[model samples]
Target: MIRNTILLAAGAAALFLSGCGEPRAYGKVDKTPYEIRECNKELYRGIDTDPEKHIDKIVVHKKKRELAMYKKGKLIYACKVSLGKNGDKGDKVQAGDYRTPEGSYRIVRKKCDPRLYKSLMISYPNAEDKARARANGVKPGGYITIHGQPKWNADGHADRFTLAHDWTEGCMAVSNKAIDALWIAVKNGVKIDIYP
Candidate 1:
């Protein structure tokens, strides 16, 4: 009888302790939520802005670390992205601030860097950005781009070490292979909407 009573007390204490502890999920956890699609031959081909189902808009969810491409208001492609190291807080204000701006912008230019991979220059510091900076008495930073990993070894070879985290001054970064697909998929003047 004493042993049974002791066992009951211990069981109750364990239940109480477990209830006081942090709640935990008791199911299978999906570690990789993002899906990376295969880069087909069309992605490797030269830039063709006049495809039948072209992606006209790009949306970025900073908190989710996702970039989705839309074709006529439909989501066609999506990939994981890394923003500026300080991008989690808010919009970029000044030069060298290391925060990705939150706003609607366009791909003003397409730059091909042999070492840094392809880059789609974003038109940051729009009128609102300038106004906000002026109000804060800061210089509005420029030269924000959506780029790929560094060409540490060769042209097509990218250093995985550099692409592992958010480490840009004020740019959005993706994989080198992802940039190669985006380079052909998107063109100049496409709208890119960035959200916090």
Candidate 2:
């Protein structure tokens, strides 16, 4: 009888404690949020005052930690890029912990979670990378791609000023909105040179 009473008291205590826990906040997202895809299409269709300029390719320099977009061999856009969390100058990332690779590559494919507003797949670990990694006995890092905020922020809205700095593991990253524009402009097999 005593044991039964003790068990009942513990259960009641647990229930009471659970009810006293803090309540989580739940509310609708602000309607002011920006949409990347819509913005990208608008930019592409807009009249260009400078018809002579055209973006041709992209170059990622690890030493300079920068991302430069080019057109007809002239730089059209340039921005800073954050490399692997471990910092620049290292072998390919064997695991996924947000580390950017260091080398020249090309944009081979572009894919997204669809659920995710934007993402671009870059072809990393070329023959040179594979040979280098094999020489060192470490696997070349793989799955390098440009992407936007994860599903948690799938609305494709993120503060640009804050995200402008380097922040990708091995892949290049721009604002979810900016990335959307690049996705349309850059095609598959477009050369992307990453320097160390």
Candidate 3:
């Protein structure tokens, strides 16, 4: 009787600790969540944006850590993203603030950096950004982008970690393969809207 009582109590405690009676999940995700234990193309297939899709708008939900692509007004593709340290807090106010700016922006340029793979530069510090910064006596920062993970992380490590946290300096980031597809699907003048 004593052993049975102890086992039941232990099970209850375990359930309580797991929160909502379910274990927490981790690692990379695509259309579905799965365990991506390490960097191996053989082990974990990368998430991709369809190149042929006519992507017109890119929407970012900072708190969700997701970037969704749209055609006309319909959702077409989405991929995991990492953002600046203060990405989920509020809009960026100044240079070197380490916060991603909020509101509508456009892809003004595309850049190549061997380390970051490829990038679509967003026109941050738009008129609104400038006004807000001016009112606060600050400098609205510029040169933000939606880009790929660092080359080292891209090779295989990102799937295990990048989506789990914020690590950028006011930029949004995706996996290399995702960027490869996005690089082709999007062009200068595409719209990008970011939200907290």
TM-score of each: 0.70, 0.61, 0.72
Ranking by TM-score: 3, 1, 2
Question: CA lDDT of each candidate?
Answer: 0.68, 0.55, 0.69
At residue 174, candidate 3 shows an lDDT of 84
lDDT of 1 at 171: 85
C-alpha displacement of 141 in model 1, angstroms? Answer: 0.7
In candidate 3, what are the lDDT values of residues 70-182, reduced to their tens digit?
A: 98899877889888866777888898777888899998876655345567889887999999999999888777888776544546443545656676778887887777667
Superposed model 2: Cα runs more than 4 Å off: 1-54, 89-93, 96-98, 114-116, 154-168
List the candidate 3 regions with Cα displacement exceeding 4 Å.
Answer: 1-52
Give lDDT tens digits, candidate 2, residues 1-196: 9996875466444322221011224354332233545534544666312334435688877667677878878877776554554445454545443456666677776553332335556777788877876887777767677665433344433334224444445555555655655665676666787666
Better of 1 and 2 by lDDT: 1
**Residue 124 error for model 1, in Å?**
0.6
Query: Judged by lDDT, which candidate is best?
Result: 3
On lDDT, the stronger of 2 and 3 is: 3
Arrange candidates by lDDT, descending. Answer: 3, 1, 2
